[model samples]
Target: MDSITQLHATTPEKLTEAILDGVRKEINDLKKEFQPKEPDEFLTRKDTAELLKISLVCLHDWCNKGIIKPYKLGNRTYFSRKELVDNVFNSNL
Candidate 1:
């Protein structure tokens, strides 16, 4: 009666392909949902300072002293969020 009905009635192969395509898309979406999210790899100097509840100067000193691993991209400096958190937790004990 309708084009959709005509298509399904005339072409079972096409219908199967369409169904498989939809299933594939759904599977991919489910995979994405189930996948573990990556932790933040780098944090800006300001963000790191605020996160640690310290001043930028002290953060810089720590960075220089290797208390926190710092990465420099262009003129901007970044710190590893994981390392900072680890250092704080490890130091508390």
Candidate 2:
């Protein structure tokens, strides 16, 4: 059930201020609920290998076998830190 409350003898300025306050509160609540995502951190092949305690050859093998994914930029390869962490947690090895 919806109940309505009537405002009696409210001035224009007071009504405007009340409406503005409600809007401001709603905006603040929305801001509180919003979260900004951090950009993914990219690592070079050598850096990724070192982070995983693996050799460059092993890293290349993993990439070839699709065990780990790589991103290419021009002629260079890169790995994402988030993806690495996720893979490590999701996989047995």
Query: lDDT score of model 2?
Result: 0.94
Estimate every model's Cα lDDT from 0 to 1: 0.83, 0.94
lDDT of 1 at 47: 91
List, residue by residue over 21-87, the lDDT tens digit for candidate 1: 9999999999999999777789998998898889999988887787788888999998888877778
Cα error of candidate 1 at position 26, Å: 25
Best by lDDT: 2
> What total of clashing residue pairs does each candidate reach?
0, 0
Q: After superposition, how far is residue 9 of candidate 1 from its true place, in Å?
A: 54
CA displacement after TM-score superposition, residue 23 of candidate 1 (Å) = 26
Worst 10 residues of 2 by lDDT: 30-39
Error of 2 at 30 (Å): 6.8
Q: 29, model 1: CA deviation in Å?
A: 23
RMSD of each: 9.2, 6.4
